[model samples]
Target: MNKIIFFAQTRELVGVDKLELAVDQMAISQLLEQLSLRGNKWSLALKEKTVLCAVNQTLVNYDYIIQEDDEIAFFPPVTGG
Candidate 1:
């Protein structure tokens, strides 16, 4: 199982602070697909055209491999100067 966190608007959309899922060794994209199936909240939340993901506080691309108990967070893109 791994611990996943969704931040900002993503957190509000999911309606939960965190989630724990038992999954085989999988990539971040696989994780997202699994999460999108969790329920209406997740499904609706990810309907946006784009969303950003990070692993353990470090920004990562979709291909990142996750291991047991890893912390992943999904959030919308940010822009600042």
Candidate 2:
């Protein structure tokens, strides 16, 4: 199983900190698309083109490929004060 993690407002919006997906491997973009289908809130929170992502604790782009047991995190782009 793969793990998906949401951070900051992304967690609040999704109402979840983590989720288990029965996927062996997939691109970050593909994962996001799948999660977005959960509903309106999911779509709005995860479908954003600018969402930041990381896999296995390393920052990655949408094309990053993740494997089974990998941990994926999603968060919004950081903004300066």
Candidate 3:
């Protein structure tokens, strides 16, 4: 199982804080595409907006391949005041 987590505005938009997916290995982009298919809110949050991603607590790009039991997190870019 792959654990997916959402934070900040991304979580508000997606309407979920976390979820578990039964995926073994897949690219981050592919995972995003799959989530976008869930509904309009998912598409708007994941496909339309730009969000930072991390796999196993290390920031990564869309090309990163997710492994089984990996913890994936999505959140908006951090801005300093």
For each of the candidates, the C-alpha root-mean-square deviation to the true structure, in angstroms, is 2.1, 1.6, 1.6
Candidate 1, overall lDDT?
A: 0.78
Candidate 1's residue-wise lDDT over 1-81, tens digit each?
Answer: 777888788889889878777654788788778788989889777653467887778988888888777788788887668
Write candidate 3's Cα lDDT for 1-81 as tens digits.
988999888899999999999755788898899999999988888863488898899999998888889999998888769
Cα lDDT over the full model 2 = 0.85
Q: Model 3: how far is 67 from its true place, Å?
A: 0.7
How many backbone clashes does every candidate have? 0, 0, 0
lDDT of each: 0.78, 0.85, 0.88
Backbone-clash count (model 2) = 0
Q: In candidate 2, what residue range of length 10 has the lowest lDDT sum?
A: 21-30
Per-model TM-score versus the true fold: 0.80, 0.88, 0.90
> In candidate 3, residue 60 scores what lDDT?
93
Q: Which candidate is the best by lDDT?
A: 3
Worst 10 residues of 1 by lDDT: 43-52
Error of 2 at 25 (Å): 2.2
Query: For candidate 1, what's the RMSD?
Result: 2.1
